[model samples]
Target: MSRFAEVLGRLAATIEARKGADASTSYTAQLLAEPARAAKKLGEEAVETVIAAAQGDKAGVASESADLIYHWLVALAACGVSLDEVAAKLEAREGTSGLAEKAARKT
Candidate 1:
């Protein structure tokens, strides 16, 4: 696997392991215990990432994107969604035009 995939896999596993941990000690646990809060954090990170990109700050974008992905994973876990399920959706979209796929979703 690519380094990116390997790191994300490890991060996801760590998040899963934090599910029932002490919330006061583990931020991931706190996020998992509060889905709404996790979602809000994910949104905040997303906005930061966008702001970084808009400013043409390559390093900032990369850093903010890492935060965004982490928060996104946490939000997904809090919502009981799995990475495999997300991958399945992406796999299903393979070869489909992005515009067509989006239009199909509007139905």
Candidate 2:
């Protein structure tokens, strides 16, 4: 498995651990304790990632991608989703045509 995939597992574990964590010691705990603020921060980081891509800044893209990943894990914590499921869905789609996939979704 890719190390990046491991990140998703780590993210899940971190969020789970955060549930009972001391806010002073765990940033994940702090984020889990907030909702709207956390969403706003995630949005900001997503925009930063987009801006970095648009600006052709590789380093900026790398930094913002990390931020995006972090906030995504936080948001997933809020929503109670599993990375494994997402990866499975992606794997299922691997051989499908993009156009066919979009058309299939509309039916």
Top candidate when judged by TM-score against the true structure: 1
lDDT of 1 by residue, 2-77 (tens): 9999999999999999999999999999999999999999999999999999999999999999999999999999
Task: Report residue 5 deviation for candidate 1 (angstroms).
Answer: 0.2
TM-scores for all candidates? 0.98, 0.82
**lDDT tens string, model 2, 22-94?**
9899778877778666687899999999999999999999999999988987876766666767789899889
- lDDT (C-alpha) at residue 56 in model 2: 100
| Per-model RMSD to reference | 0.5, 2.0
In order, candidate lDDTs are 0.97, 0.84
Error of 2 at 24 (Å): 4.5
Pairs that collide in candidate 1 are none
Q: After aligning candidate 2 to the native by TM-score, how far in Å is the CA of 38 from where it should be? A: 2.7
The clash tally of candidate 1 reads: 0
Cα distance off (Å), candidate 1, residue 15: 0.1
